[model samples]
Target: MDVDEERQRSLKRSLLCLCAAELVMMVNTTAFNVALPNIAESLGAGMAEQQWIVSSYNLVFAAVVLLAGFMGDRLGHLRTMIAGLGMFVVASAIGLAAGNVPVLLVSRSIMGAGAGVVIPMGQALLGILFRGPALSRAMTAWAIAGTLGVPFGPLVGGALTATLGWRGIFGFDGVVFLAVIAVIRMNVPRTGGSRKSRSLHVPWASVAMMFAGFTLFSAGLVNAQHGVLTAGAWMPMAVGAALITGFVLHDRASRNPLMELGLMRDPSFAACAPALMMLNFSMYGIIFIMPAYLETVLRHGALIGGMLLMPLVVASIAGARMNDRIVSRIGPRGTSLLALGCLAAGMLTIGAAMWWPDGMMRQSTVLVGQLMAGLGLGAGQPAMLTWAMGRVPIGQSGAGSSLLTVFRQFGSIIGVGIFGSIQSGLYTAEFHDLAQSAGLAPQSAGSVTLDFQRAADMTGMTGDLMRQAASRAYESAMTGSFAAAAAVIAATLGVVALISRRTPR
Candidate 1:
């Protein structure tokens, strides 16, 4: 074979290895969701603690991504990725050994940090390896791996948890990491010396401001679900707003800023960022609540719940692959609008399913809605990523991609915390009312409430009273979540429309 042909073959192999590494990272993120109840049961965790298991990982992941992106640029993507894989392997092992909630959470946070490093670096390497149509094809594959991981994680993790137990998921992750390490060592070519080490001087003030702002924004949304009207919630939200404002100003002023403010100013990035966040917010909100609705309200097992939800992931992979062709034909704006419409329609369909009379037919309706919703999400994601990153300078692709991932993570955090709180509050109130109506004694009513709460906590419940109450409450919560998601999608449509109008297509 010719030398150029050999080089091309080598590059393709490296990109595939990078994609494998990224898939491992993505699996770790969602694998824990299906295992949340099992983790809580084994650790004797409360709702707040279990929530932390998910949220803390996202919190650290989102917070460190910008920094990690810069490090990838300065430290050489290959070197940084190897280091990240090492951290991930260690973190997974620690999580496997964790005997308590705090230890598990700490492990998750470390894992998130490792992920934050690995993802952007892998994307950066891909960007460096391919160009033009080749670049697009490489990215299309990358996006598919990512989209597949979210849904596939739970399906596999559910099976693993049932068979080998929750801890086994971590062991699986460890094995995956070891395999990736071997691939990286063998296939990934060394791209010579690192760029001059960028000074490790983080803008402490800006970092503080960003965290405060995100925390406040998340807290406010969380409080809103509980009907809590307090200054504490609103205060942080306001403070967060001010902090973000200051952060932008600081970025503009800094000689070597952590993030490029100019990137945010790009029309494509600005428009696509919010749209991406909304897409994830809606997608995760559905993922978070739907399983509970299926298992507890419909009396399905973990296997069945996972199986019924398969359409979302399956359609997402299809949509992402199709997005490349769709973008070429319709352009980003038109394609995004069409995709968002599909998403809104899917959510509405799910809401309608809830309103339907309970029976096998309602279950079928819900399943159909989930399939449509998955299609919408899958279609939207790749187009959004392409539009956002395509507009940025090639050198800054790592930073831009990291920003997209960070916003998506933040959206997940916001979605789960807000939606979970809403579902919990509504379920608790409805269960209490139903128990009283059933003429149970006060003590019995309390016991019923406790059982309902346990079901919510476990993400499943089945009993005559518990089922009736849980069905009513879960239906209400799911409907509300869908409505909110629809509103967000509508807003995204407006944003993308404005962008299409201003920018020459």
Candidate 2:
């Protein structure tokens, strides 16, 4: 009956709506992984094209999010979010109607732009609504909504693709975002974009430099898998490194930098970026590879592969729900260290499973590893967000949150591009050798190695043998990839240790 209570209730509703909108964005990100095989099949995409399908969105998102964050601060969160959601709807329409690979990629990139704008403002709105304990709880809810999309994304995508078809997937996103726009218009309070002069400092140069740097770097990594020593691989990498250096120098010289480069000077906020990067590197890296492995190498349907990921998804949800409680009890440092340890253990376990000779047992081992990895990331990630954002000035919440997203997306690009390339290369080499040893001609064996369905077409007892050989090769490659990931995770653990020691008890 009181105005204050009524205001509080309305704010909560707005937060819930924003969380829901964010969930839609997160779902669009990973849901497409399950759909990639179907999309590739429909569009006749190759390995590089398939990887690009996933990476293109991430690359654009990472590059542009910082600008969006700054814009949200200057332009007003609600208004910026509406613009982003509108872009999402248009992109979804493009995706729904896309008849070829190039068009689909362009559509995905535009969707990434929308997401880059919307997501940071979602976090900024939470910062606007709550602080301290309430802030902690709000973040957990927001993170859970986003995290839910990760594990369940495949299942939702799989079912949609199987039942309604891949086009329906984009159709669903378009419909939800349209509804979200209506909700925002009706529910969210509006304010002017800027209280100060509207001539805000927008760093167009930084955007160009960062985008070029990440693009070249990722392209180089993808090329490395196929041609490790080629100019195509190393030259781009060198150029990328140079561009990134230029970006840092350029950003530092800017009167109002796109991101607070000074934030890295603070130990806790600094560590969070790398920690977030590795968390995604470990999480999305495996996720990027799994569907293809299950569908192509194991000859399972996309639905089955999606279903198999349920344990990982379930465990992640459980972990994210428990995050606030864990942080409350053990503190952020302890919580982060625990999560990092879980990630390392999980990756190592997956590596072991990949090394296992028995196929059935390997699947079980992978499931267990997924559980550990999911829980680790789900719990630790919120803590990183909490700790990092807690240090940010409230006025710049959008910028801070967007920087965090940039790091995460950057990691995703690295994880998918590099890991996929490595897995593909290793599998190619092993499958080629095995096919020749099976008495097949090198050319025929080479052709089969190039195409997944052809490998499946080998029939009867010989076909079974060939399939088994290919599976072993894939497993070996996957194990190697997991092991490498585990090493990266271990380094992440070291970073957590530094934060843990400095964090107050």
C-alpha lDDT (0 to 100) for residue 448 of candidate 1? 22
Question: Ten-residue segment with the worst summed lDDT in candidate 1?
Answer: 440-449
Candidate 1: clashing residue pairs, number? 1
C-alpha lDDT values of all predictions:
0.71, 0.80
lDDT of 1 by residue, 1-505 (tens): 9999999999889978987887777667766776765565577664456556776776777777777776666666778778888877898899889998888988888887788778877777776777666777777777778777777777877787888888889899888898998899899976522465456565667667676666666666555544546775566666766876787688779887878668877777787777777676766677666755654456564556666677778888888778878879988777777888888788877877777775777777777877777777777776777677677665676677678777777777777777666666565566567656764321222212235445454433234555566467667666776776677677777876786666546
RMSD of 2: 2.2
> Model 2, clash count?
1
- What would the per-residue lDDT of candidate 2 be over residues 223-317, giving only the tens digit for each residue? 87777789988999899989988998998898877876777777777778878887778767877888877776776777787888788778878
Runs of candidate 2 with Cα error greater than 4 angstroms are: 191-198, 441-450, 456-466
Error of 2 at 352 (Å): 1.4
RMSD of each: 3.4, 2.2
Residue 5 miss distance in model 2 (angstroms): 1.8
Each candidate structure's TM-score, on Cα atoms with residue i matched to residue i, is: 0.90, 0.94
**In model 1, which regions exceed 4 Å deviation?**
190-194, 197-200, 440-463
